[model samples]
Target: MASPIDNNVSSAKAVLLGALASGVNGPTWSMIKITFLTLGVCLAAMLALAFSSSDFIMIIHVLLLVVISGILLVLLNRFLAETGLVSIEQQMEEMGIATKDQIELSKKS
Candidate 1:
C-alpha cells in the first residue's frame, strides 16, 4: 500500500503532467497569444532602434524584454484570478487534491 505522503506526491505529479499535456483554457490561451504578439512587436521596435543607433547595449534589450513580460504576466494573472477563471485553491478542492477539513487540520499543525 502506498503511504499518504506518496499518494499526495503521485497525485501532485499527475495533476502537473495532465496540465502540461492538456494546455490552458480559452481565456488563458488568448492572453498568451496577446503576450506573444506584444513581445514580437516590442522585439521588432527594439531591433529597429538598435539598427538605427551606433551604440546599442544588448543587456538593456534583454532587461526590457524581461521586465515587460514579467509585468504583463503579473497583470494578466491577477485579472484572471479576479474573474474567477483561475482559482488554484478551488480547483484543488474540486479535484480531491485538498479538502476543507484537511486544510484546517494542516493549518492547526
Candidate 2:
C-alpha cells in the first residue's frame, strides 16, 4: 500500500538513523564543528576576494585555509589529550549522558 515516495522517505530516515547510531566521538564532533567554522570563514574570505583575486587563486586560498584549519584542530585535540585535562571521550560521554555502547549493554540486560 506504500507509495514509492513513502519508501524513499523511509529509506532516507533509516540511513540517517544509521549514521547517527555510528559512534561519533569527541574528536569527530570537534572536526565537524571545525569544518563548518572553516566553511563560514571561507565564504567570507571568498566574498572579500571576489573583486581582488582571480577564480583560481581564490580556490587555492580556500583550499589552503581548509587544510590549515584541519591541521590546527587536530593539534588542539592532541594537546588536550596529552594534557591532564579531562579527555574528549569523557567529555562527550558526560554530555551525551549515555553512549551507544552503554545503550547496547542496557538493551542486552
Candidate 3:
C-alpha cells in the first residue's frame, strides 16, 4: 500500500504531465507571440509620439501609426495563414504529407 505522501506525489506528477502535454499542442504560444508583436508596434508608435514636439502632430502621428499597424497586422495574418504557418492542417495538406483519407484510415485502425 502507498503512503498518502506517495499518492500525492504521483497525483502531482500526473497533473504536471497532463498540463505539459496539453500546452505542447495548444495555441498559447502563438497567441503570446502575436500579443508581443502588437505590444512592440504600440511601443514603437509611442516612441514616435514622444519624439514629436507638437501635440496635434503627435495625435495625428499616433492615429496614422495605429491605422497602418492595423492594416499591416491584417495583411500579415492573411499572409501567414496562406503560408500555413498559422494552421497545421493546411500545412500538412499543402505538403501532401497527411491527407484526410490517411487520417481517416488511421482513426479506423
Report the number of the highest-TM-score candidate: 3
Model 2, 1-109: lDDT tens digits are: 3323223334334333323544433434455566678776866677568536667776777767767777877776686566533333333344564475854544455
Tens-digit lDDT string for candidate 3 (1-91): 3323223334334333323442211143355456768876776768576667568777776767767766776775676556442233223
TM-score of each: 0.34, 0.33, 0.36
List candidate 1 stretches off by more than 4 Å.
Answer: 1-23, 56-109
How does each model score on lDDT? 0.56, 0.52, 0.50
Least lDDT summed over 10 consecutive residues: which range in candidate 2?
Answer: 1-10
lDDT of 3 at 97: 46
Best by lDDT: 1
Q: Against the correct fold, how does model 1 do in TM-score?
A: 0.34
Q: Where does candidate 2 clash, by residue pair?
A: none
Error of 2 at 26 (Å): 12
Error of 2 at 61 (Å): 0.6
Better of 1 and 2 by lDDT: 1
